[model samples]
Target: MKLSEIKEILATAEGVNFKLENGISVPAHFHVTEVGIITRDFIDCGGTVRHEKVANLQLWDADDHEHRLKAGKLLHIISLSEKVLGMEDLEIEVEYQAETIGKYDLGFDGENFLLLTKKTACLAMDNCGIPAEKQKVEMVNLASASTCTPGGGCC
Candidate 1:
């Protein structure tokens, strides 16, 4: 999901709810502590230079359970961020701490916003020295001494 997408969603929703991939929900008392743009620049193992940019939202579970973030209020916050920070319509990356500080790709599953797990992959599979995984082979196809074919077998 992108900033523009969430803005559009917030425009229509009655409340803002975030659901994890495990079916747990971010508490209604959660606060969106931070919203900003993140830019990453790095070199891949394949020697390719790359850059990525995303709008980041950091959700912090707070002690206050009285305030539930309504759709309108969330939209208002986003609007303020846009006006003050000049954020663009970049994809959203959410930071939430469970057992660890996990970063996730943001998405929506119709009724609620979903936190999709992100993974790091080798971008240069072909350039890497790692061998490809071997395919499973039938054991019966092996020429064992016990099963040597015909008279040609010295066994």
Candidate 2:
């Protein structure tokens, strides 16, 4: 999902909830610690220059179990970030602590926000040395096929 989408969702959302792709819910008391733009500029292995930008929302499971980040409050923070930082309506990326700080793409499933896992891919697959994936075809045995005959079961 994108920044604008979330802002719209927050307008009527009764509660703010986030869940991992695996169905594990983020703690209710979790806090959105940061909202900022993340920009990446780099050269790929295929020697192509690339750039990326996203609106980042970092979640922190705070010790204050009583604290629940309300939808309106989050909207306020987002509104401030936009006005103060001049943030763009870029795709949303979420940073949450798992075993380490895991970066995820944002999604919404009608009722809950989803933190989808991110995967790396060769940006210039055609230029990269890695071979393209081969088409898979299931093999069937024709060796046991019946032969045409007048009255044989082999037919």
Candidate 3:
């Protein structure tokens, strides 16, 4: 989700909640410890230069079990980051602690925010010589019986 969309959602929401793709919820007492803009510049396997920017939100769980981040508070934090860091309407990437720190793409499912699992993909598939998917056809649809009959001169 984009930063603007998140801000809009925060405006009407009461509590902030994040759920993993597997139906597991981030602890209610989580804290958004950091908010910033991340920029990535690199070269793909095809030697093409590329750049990406994303708004980052780092969630941390502390011993303070009573702490809960309200939607308004999170929105305030985002506003401050935007003002000071000059952040744009970039996609939001959330970093939260599981067994270790994991990064996720942010999404909303009407009722709650979802933390989607991230995956690595090859941007230069053609350059890397990956074969294109082949089309499949049924044997029965291959040819007409009149075109290739048993013991016929055509066959």
TM-score of 2: 0.89
* lDDT for each residue of candidate 2 in 1-155, tens digit (9 for 90 to 100): 98999999999999999999999999999999999999999999889899999999999999999999999999999999999999999999999999999999999999999999999888988898889889999776566645644576665
What is candidate 3's lDDT per residue for 61-135, written digit by digit as tens?
Answer: 888899989999999999999999999999999999889999999999977899999999899988988888899
Model 2 segments more than 4 A misplaced: 138-155
Query: What pairs collide in candidate 1?
Result: none
- Highest lDDT model number: 2
Q: Distance from true position, residue 70, model 1, in Å?
A: 1.2
Clashes of 2: 0
TM-score of 3: 0.89
Worst 10 residues of 3 by lDDT: 137-146
Q: After superposition, how far is residue 115 of candidate 1 from its true place, in Å?
A: 0.8
